[model samples]
Target chain A: MDFATLIQILDSTVRLATPLLFACLAGLFSERAGVFDIGLEGKMLAAAFLSGAVAAVTGNVWLGMFAGIGASLLMAAIHGLASITFRGNQLISGVAINFLAAGLTVLLGQNWFGLGGRTPALTSGGRFEPIILPFAEAMAPVPVLGPIYSELISGHSFPVYLAWAMVPATAWLLYRTRFGLRLRAVGENPAAVDTAGVSVTAIRYAAVAICGVLCGLAGAYLATGLAAGFGKDMTAGRGFIALAALIFAKWRPWYALGACLLFGFLEAVGNRFPNIDLGLIVLPAQFMQALPYILTVVILAGFVGKAIPPRAGGEPYVKER
Target chain B: MTAMPKWADAVLVPLISLLIAFVISGLVILAIGENPMEAMRIMVSGALGSTYGWGYTLYYATNFIFTGLAVSVAFHAGLFNIGGEGQAGVGGLGVALACLYIPWPHWSLALAAALVASAVFGAAWAAIPAWLQAKRGSHIVITTIMFNFIASALLVYVLVNILRPTGSMDASSARFAEHLRLPRLNEILALVGIPFNNRNPANISFLLGLVACVAVWVLMWRTRLGYELRAFGKSEKAAVYAGISPVKITMAAMLISGALAGMMAVNTVMGEAQRLILNSVEGAGFIGIAVALMGRSHPFGVLLAALLFGFLYQGGAELALWTKIPRELIVVIQALVILFTGALDNMVRRPVETLFLMARKGR
Candidate 1:
C-alpha cells in the first residue's frame, strides 16, 4: 500500500506482464489475419521447455531462445497445415496442438533429463540477467521519480523492456503498414482480398508464423527471464490469460499492453497478499488469479461492452468455393 | 448419392486416421530411443491381460463415457461444449454435498439423489455460458474456456476454505459414511456368482455409464427433439424456416451436454474417492473432446472411443511405471488422434474418396 511496496508490486508487474504482452500481440496478429489461435498456450509451453532445456545444456540463453522459437514454429506450421491448408476445424487443431505440446514437452523432458519432466536448473549465463539502466543509481537520489525509475523500470531483464517496446512497434505495424492493411482486409473479408490478388493463405500463414515467434519470446521469457528454468506446464494457462487480455484489449496493440499490465498487477497483488480480510468478507488469492478470465467473460457477454471479432475469423478461405 | 459406402464413411476413414496417428506416435517413440513395438506390447498386455487391468481400464472408461457422451450430444446440436471439465468439477461438488449432508437410509436412494444433484449443478455451471452464446452472440468456445478456469477457482476456494476438515493439510471433503459408498463392481459381480478383481476402484457406476449410453442413443436418434436438434445443427437458417427455435435447441443441447458431463463425477468422486477433492475431474473433461471426435459424435462410437482411451490411460500408467517412457505418451497419442480424426480429417478423407470414385468408375 505504501510507495515502496507499490513500486515493488509494479516491478513484479512488469516481470509478470512481459510474457502476457508478447502472447497478446501474437494473438492480435493471428486473429487479425483471420486465423484463430487457441494454441498459444501450447506453443508457449513448448518454447518454455525447449528454451529451458537448451539453456541448461548449452549454457547459452540466446541459443535457448532460438530453440524455443523453433519448437513453437514447428507447432505453428502444423496448425497452419491443418487449419489453413486442409481447411480443418481451427478450434480442434488448436486443442490438438495444446495437447501435443503438453505431452511431448513432458515426455521428452523426462526422457532427456530424467528428472521427472523438469530441465536442469538454469545457471547464471543460462538465465537472462537483470540489466541496470545507466542512470538508475543517479536517479535513486531523487525524491518522487527516483524509486519509480530505479526500482520499477530500471532493473527488469531484457524481455520486459522488449515486451513494452513491442506495443508501439506492433501498433505501427498494424495501423500504418501496407501489409497490415491487407492483413486486416483478409481477416475482415478474405474474398475481397483474394479478388484484389492478395493471397489470403499467404497472409494467414505469415500472421500465424508471427504469432509463433511472439509466443516463442513469451515462453523463453518464462523459462530464462522470469523463472530460472522450465517446469512442467510452466506456462500454466498464461496463454489463455493472454487470449483473455486480447479480447479485453479489443485486439489492439496499445490496449493489449494495458490489459496485460493490469492482469499482471492483479497477479502481483495476489502474490504479495495471499489472503485479505476486510473485517467481513475475506478474498482468496484464487479470485485474483481468476479475475482476468471472469472479466473477459463479462466483456464477452456484452455486459461491459461488445468485443466483436474479425468477420472472416475462424473460417478457411476457399477460393473456388 | 454418396461417393463411398456408408460403412466406409463410418468406419474406414477413422481407421485410416487412427493408423496414421499410431504410426506417428511410433516414430515419436523411436525418436526417444525406445522401441515402439515393445511399448505397444506392454500397453496391450498391461491394459487387457489381467482382470485387475480391466478393472482400472473399465473404471477410467466410465468417466470417459459420461464426458464423451456429453460432447457428442452438444456436437449433434451444433454446439461445441468444451466446459466439460468445469461442469464435471461442479458436479463432483454436488455429489460431495449430497453424500455428506443428506441422511439417506439406503445407498440406492443416495445414488439417485446424488445423480440428480450432480446433473443439476453441472447444468447450472454451463447455463450461463450457453445463455450468453444463445442470446448475446458470445462464442461458446471462448466463454466455456473462461468458465473452466472460473470453476477451478471456485473448487479451490470451496475445498480449501469450506470443505477441508480442520487441521487437514489436503484440500478435500471429509469422507462419506461407509454404508453410503456405492458398491464395488466386484461386489455386484460376486452377488451373481461371477468372479472379478476385488481390490480395484471399479464400481457400479460403470454399469450406470453403460445405461446412460443407451439412454443417450434413444434420446438422440429415436426422439422428436433429437430430430429437431440435428436439423438445427445441420442448417440453422433452414431449421429456423422450418419452425425450430434456435434458442430452445441451443439451451436444450447444452443442458444435456452439461448433465452428461456432470454424471462423470459419480464415477470419480462417489465411486472411487468417496470424497470431493480438488482436481477430481483431472483432464477427463478434455479427454471427452478427443473421444467424441474419434467416435464421430455417436453414442456407440463414444463408448468405443472411451474404452480405447481408458486402455491407453491404464497401459500408459504401466508403461511409465516400468519403462523409460512417461505416461504422457498416451496424451501425445491422444493429440495425434484428435489432429487426424477431427482437424485433419480431409487429409485422409480426400484421398480415400478419390480412390473409391476411381474404383467405381473402373467397375
Candidate 2:
C-alpha cells in the first residue's frame, strides 16, 4: 500500500473508536459514583434498538439519538433505583438489566420491523452521514495525505467529534467543577459529603444520568452512525469493549478515552490484520479476536497497579442516625 | 441492604416487582403482536404436559443443578463467578479433548478421567479470579466478566484451530464412544408395565445431580467447613477474628464452585450428549446465578431452583416445536425468573433467619 493508503487506514481507525469512547466515559461516570454499572452492554443495546426504530419511523437522526439516550437513561435510572435506593446487589441488578434488555429488544424488534433480527434499513436522511470539513476537500489536492484527509479526518459521523469532545468535557466536569468535587467526595465517603449538606442521591443520580446519556449516544452511533440500522446485537460486544477500556483507564475520563482509542486500534487491526503477512506468525484469526478480552484480563489481573476504585465505588450510602 | 427484614414487605415486594416485570413484558409482547395469555399457556403446557416434554425439561434442569450450585458456592465465598458460560464451555472442552485424544478403553475409566479433567480445568479457570481477588484485591465482578470474554474467545479459537470435527457446520470435537454415553433407564420404566413413549437418553445424571445436591447440603450444613464459610460470608473480619483464614476459605470456595460447574459438563457430555460439542451447556452458567439466587443460596434451594429452571427450559424448547412463538421467548422467561429472583433476593433468607432468632430469644 502507498503512504496515502496507510494514512487513510489510521484515520478510519479513529472513526471506529467513537462508540467505544462514548461507552467507556459512560462507565467511568457511573462506576466512579459508587454504582457498579455492569450493564453497559444492555444499555447500549436497548438504546440501539430504540434509536433504530425511532429513526426509521421518524426519519430524523437527532430524534433517534435523543430517543436512544432516553432509553439508556431510563435503564440507568433503574440501576440507580435498585442499587442506590433499594440498595440491591449491584452486580445482580446490572445483570438483570442486561438480560431484560436483551430479550425485550429482540422480542419487540422482530415483531415491529418484520425482520428476524433487525430493524428496517435506514437511509442517510434517517441516519448520520460523515461530515466533510470545509476546505478539507480542497486540502485533498495535496500529495501523500489527500486520501487521508478525505477518508479519516474530513469525513466521519458527527458523533465522532462529540465523542472526542466529551473527553475534555468529562475531564472538566469530573475535575474542575464543584459537582466534580462532590462526586469525588461521595464516591470516597458519602458520610463526609452528607455532613457537608450535599444529597448523595442527587449527585449520584446526576452522575448516573450522564452515564446513561453517553451509553445512549454510543448506541445511536452504533446503529444510525456506523451501520445505518440496528442489527440484532448491533452494539455486539462493543459495550463490553468500552468496559474493557473503563477498567484499563481505572475509572478516569481522559484515560478511558485513551484506553478506548488503544482498544479501538486493536479492533481496527482485527478488521484489517488479515491483510498483513508476517512470515511465521501464523496466529489464528480466532486468537486475534480474543485479544481484547485477553488484554482486559491481563490488565485486571494486576499488570496495572491497583485498579483501586474510589474508596467506596460500589457501596450505597445510608446516613447514620 | 439491611440484614434484617420487616415481615409485610417480604412477600409483597418480590411479587409486586414480578407483577411489574410481567406487566412490562406483556406490554412489550403486545406491542410486538403477540398475545400474553396465549404465550403463557404455550409456555406452561410446553414444559409440563407430557413425559417426553418433561424429560427435556429435566435435562435442562440437570445442568441448572450444577450451575446453581456453582453460583451458590461462589456467593458464599463472596466471589461472583459470572463466568458460568465460559467455565461450562471450558469444562465441556476439557472432557471433549480427553475423550477424543486420551487413550482410555474402559468405559468407567474414561468417564472418570473425563469428569476429573473437566473439574480441574474448570476449577483452574475460576482460580484466575480467585487469585486476583486474594492476591491483589482486584474486583472479582469485573475480572470474572473479563474472564468470560476471554473464555468465549478462546473457545471459538479452540473449536476452529484444534477441535474441528470433520464434515460438520457446527465446530465441535469428535463424538464420544458409545461406552461413554450416559446410560438411560428412562426406557426401563416399561418393566412394571407403566410404559412411557419417547426413547431419549435422559440418563442417570439427574440422579447424580440429586446426589450432588445432597452432598452440597452436607457440605454446607453438616460440616465445620461450611460453618466457617458461612461465617466468612456474613463478616470476613469476624471470620478472621474467629481464626479462619480468609484467603484459604475463599480459594476453597471458588475452586469448589468451579469444580461443580465443570461437573455440569460431565453430566452433559458423558451422561446425555456423550460428546463435548461446542456451546455445550450454552447459557446454563448465567442461568445458574438465577437458580442460586432463587434457591436462596442453600443446597436444597439450589436443587429445587435448578429443577424450576430446567422445567422452564424444557418447556420452552417444547413450546417452540408446538407453537408459533419463537425460541427466544425462553430467554424472556429466564430473564423474568432472574428479575423476580433479584427482586425477592434481599428478603429471602433474612426473614426466616429473623424468625429463628426470635424463637430462640423467646425461649
Candidate 3:
C-alpha cells in the first residue's frame, strides 16, 4: 500500500482501538481485584445510550459524559450487590446486567425520544471533535516526520488521548500504589489480604467502580466521539472482544494496549478491503472480522500460550468462612 | 439440618422467584403509563386463551426444550456450553442442505435425515471447544462464546454466497418441496379428530422435543454414562480417582449437548419456516441458559421452564402489539427472572429455610 493508504489505516486503528483500550483497562481492574466482570459490554451500552440521550437534551457533551459515568456506576453497583453482597454467581449476574442494559436502553430510549430506540443526532457542542495539534500545520512541510506527526499523532477526539494516557496511569496505579497492592492481593488470595487488615469487599467494590468509570468513558466515546448518536445494542460485542483482548494481553495494562491495537489494526484492514485476493484464493471480510475471536480461542487452547486468571476470581468472598 | 421438604425446595423457590419477578415487571409496566393488571390480562389471553395462542407458545417452547436440554447435558458434565446459539445456527444449515439437496419421498424420511445431519453438524461445531477444554486446559466459557460469533459469521457467508436462491433478494434459501415439509400440528391433531389452529406454526417437532426430553431423562438418571457424567460434574478429581476419564466424560457430555441444541433447527427450519434463514435461532440459545438454570438442569424441569418462557415470549409479543410497551421490555423481565431464580436464589432460599427450621423446632 501507498503511504497515504497506510496513514489512513493507522488513523482508523487509533480510532477503533481507543474504546477497546479503555474497556481492556476496565476489565483489568475488576478481574485483578477478584471480581470477574463480563458485564463491561452492558455497562458500556448503558453509558452510550445515556450519554447520547443526555447530550441531545442538554446540548452539553461534558454533562453527557458525567451522566454516562453515573449510569455505568449504577450498573456496576447492581453487579457488586448481586455478586459481592448477595453472594450470587458472578457469571450469571454479569449476564443479567447485559440483558438489563440491552432491554432498558431500548425501552427507555424509545419512550423518551420516540425515535425507535435511538437518541437525537448531536450537533457541534454535543459531540467530541478531532483536535489538531499546534505544530501539525507548521510541520507539514517536513517529509517523513511531518505526516507521522500531523496524521498519526495529532488529530483525534479527546478520549483517544485519554485512553493512551490511562495505560501509564493504570500501570503506575497497579504497581506503585498501596491500594493496588491490596487489590492484587485480594484477587490472588482474599484470606491473606483480609489477614493483613484489608477489607476484601471494599477493595473489590472500589475496583468495580473504577471499572465502571473506564467503561463509561469508552461508551461515551462510542456514542459522542465515534458516532453522533446511540443505537440499540450499539456496543455490539466490543465488550466481549475487549475481554478476549484482556486474555490475549495476560491481564497487563501495557499488553492490553498492544492487543487492542493489534485487534484494531485487523478491523481497519477488514474495513479497507472487503475482499482480499491472494495468489491461490480470495479471503472474505467476515474471516477478518472474526479473526480476534478465533485467535482468542486459539490462544486459550494453548496453541499460542496459556491465559491464567486471578486465583480468587469469580468466587464470592465470605469473610467468616 | 434439613429445613424444608424436597418437593417444596424444588417447586416453592422457583414459584416465589417467578412471582417476585412478575410483581417487579408489573411496576415497570405501570411506570410506562400502562395498567399492569390490564397488561397481565392481555398477556394471559394472548398466550394461552385459544388454540392459536397455544400453538405459538408450544412452537417457542419446542425450540427452548432443545436448547435447554443441550445446556443441561453440558451442565451435568461441569461444562458451561454457552455456544448453543451457534450450534443451533449451524444445525439450521444442516436442515437446509438436507431439504434442498436431497430428494425425499416423504416428510417422515426427510425429517429423520435432517435430524441426523443437524446433530452431526452441531456436534462437530462443539467438538473443537470441548477438546480444547478437556485436553488443552482452555476455559470452555470464553471459547464457546467466541464460537457463537464465528458461527454467526460463517452462517452469513454460507447463506449469502451458497444457499441463496438464484437472483433472490433475500438471504434465505428456497422453500423445501411439498413432500419434504413436516406435518403441521393441525394436521396431526386432525387425525385424532381434534380441532386445532391451522394458522399457527407449531408442528410435529413438538412431539420430537417431548421424545427427546424423555430420552434425556432416561439417559441421565437410568444409564451408567449419565451416572458417570453427573459424578464427573460433581467432583472431577474424585471421578478421575474412580477411573473415569475426564476427557471422555467432557467430550461425551458436550457432544450430547450439541446434538440436542441442533435439534432446535428441526422445529424452526423444517416444521415452521420450511426454509433456512438468518436469525432462525432468534436468541433461543441464550434463553435456554435461563431455562436450564430455572429448571435446575433436569429434563423435566427444563420442559416446564421452557413452557413458562414460551408463555412469556408469546405474551410479550402480544403486549408489544396491543400496548405502548416496547418489545424489549420482555427481555428485561426475562433478565429479572434469571437474576432472581439463578443469581439471587440464596436470597429467598435462606429466608425460607430459616422459617422452615423455626417451624420444625416449634413442633
* Chain A superposition TM-score per model: 0.98, 0.95, 0.98
Per-prediction TM-score of chain B?
Answer: 0.99, 0.85, 0.98
Which candidate has the top score in lDDT? 1
Error of 2 at B120 (Å): 1.1
Per-prediction TM-score to the true structure, in the order listed: 0.99, 0.93, 0.98
State residue A57's C-alpha deviation in candidate 2, in Å. Answer: 1.8
DockQ (Cα-based) for each candidate: 0.89, 0.60, 0.80
Kindly report the docking quality category of candidate 1: high
Model 2 lDDT at residue A119: 86
Top-DockQ candidate index: 1
* Whole-model lDDT per candidate: 0.94, 0.79, 0.91
Tens digits of per-residue lDDT for model 1, A1-321:
788898898889989999999999999999999999999999999999999999999999999999999999999999999989999999999999999999999999998999889999999999999999999999998997999999997988888888999999999998999999999998999999999998999999999999999999999999999999999999999999999999999888998999999999999999999987889988888888889999999999998979999999899889976
**Pairwise DockQ winner, candidates 1 and 2:** 1
Q: How much native contact recovery, as a fraction, does model 1 achieve? A: 0.84
Model 3 lDDT on a 0 to 1 scale: 0.91
Please identify model 2 stretches exceeding 4 Å from their true place.
A275-280, B1-33, B166-169, B188-194, B199-201, B322-324, B343-363
Among residues 3 or more apart in sequence or in different chains, the pairs in candidate 1 whose N, CA or C atoms overlap within 3 Å are none
Candidate 3 lDDT, tens digit per residue, A111-225?
8888989999999999998889999999977988888889989999899999999999999999999998998998999999998888898999999999999999999999999
What is candidate 3's lDDT per residue for B14-83, written digit by digit as tens?
8898889889888888876789999889889999999999999999999999999999999899888889
lDDT of 2 by residue, B1-363 (tens): 443355424444444445665676667567666687887687677777777767777778889998899999888867688877777778887788788787787766877787788888888888988888887777777777877778887887777666777666777666777666655646546655665545554666777788888888899888998888888888999999999998888888888888889888877877777665667777889999888877778787788778777776776666557654556665776676675567335444455557657876788
Fnat across every predicted model, in order: 0.84, 0.50, 0.76
**Candidates by lDDT, descending order:** 1, 3, 2
Error of 3 at A157 (Å): 1.3
